[model samples]
Target: MLKKDIHPEYGPCQVACACGNRFETRSTLKEIKVAVCSSCHPFYTGKRGAVVIEAGRVEKFQRKYAGTRFGKPAQETEEKEQG
Candidate 1:
């Protein structure tokens, strides 16, 4: 026999995502919030533009190493040649 009042309550719950997608489901909590969902997820929706970038990280990295040579930096290259 199953114990009564031992398990947490399960009822209808609302899920909201960062992309403004909302759905209803059953859960212990009354409301749920998530950063990603099927509607906005890149893998699920198969959209390349869905990717989110912050603070121009790719641009910053390119700028920082724009003058550097390939593979190793100048200091490492010099050290390798000496040893």
Candidate 2:
């Protein structure tokens, strides 16, 4: 068993989810703010890609890196072009 006074205060943690799901769990912190939770999570709720569609995070990333080549260094590309 852990000796008393050696550990940080462990008490109920109030979690506030973006989807209006509030639950209490044991943690060192008193409160936590989260963007997703089991109630509204895509995996738990069986919502495939719904969050991505609504948030546009995936689409925005794809658009930002669509033209970028992967696994090829910029210097290697320049050397190939020069030779």
Candidate 3:
């Protein structure tokens, strides 16, 4: 059984960040830091953009229609007038 104490302790103390970002706060222990804060982080600073790409997608499509007639010019349609 654990008894109630006036103070508590936490792990992972002094978390120094790689982006030179640091701050102080309270958790289950003392002293804590983090890497990549809102000042330079991609997500926090909105610097990163969406990524969209598929493997062999462009190649697959080109191989599927190597020399098809799909690129042909549009066909001319006759127009009729009704009174």
Error of 2 at 36 (Å): 0.7
* RMSD, candidate 1, Å: 5.4
In candidate 3, which residue pairs get closer than 3 Å at backbone N, Cα or C atoms, i.e. clash? 9-28, 10-28, 10-29
Candidate 1 residue lDDT tens string, 1-83: 87998999999999998888999999999999887889987889888667543435777787787656654578986876799
Instruction: In angstroms, give how far residue 30 of model 1 lies from its true place.
Output: 0.4
Candidate 2 residue lDDT tens string, 1-83: 99988899989999998878899999999999888888888889897765532577666777777656544579877877799
Candidate 3: C-alpha RMSD to true structure equals 12.6
Clash pairs (backbone) in predicted model 2: none
Residue 16 miss distance in model 3 (angstroms): 2.9
Model 3 agreement with the true structure over 1-83: per-residue lDDT tens digits: 66668556644455446566566554675665554555665666776642213335677887887556443333411121221
RMSD of each: 5.4, 4.7, 12.6
> Could you say which candidate leads in TM-score?
2
lDDT of every model, 2 decimals: 0.80, 0.80, 0.53
TM-score of 2: 0.66
* Model 3: CA > 4 A from native: 1-3, 6-15, 49-83
TM-scores for all predictions = 0.61, 0.66, 0.35
lDDT of 3 at 10: 47
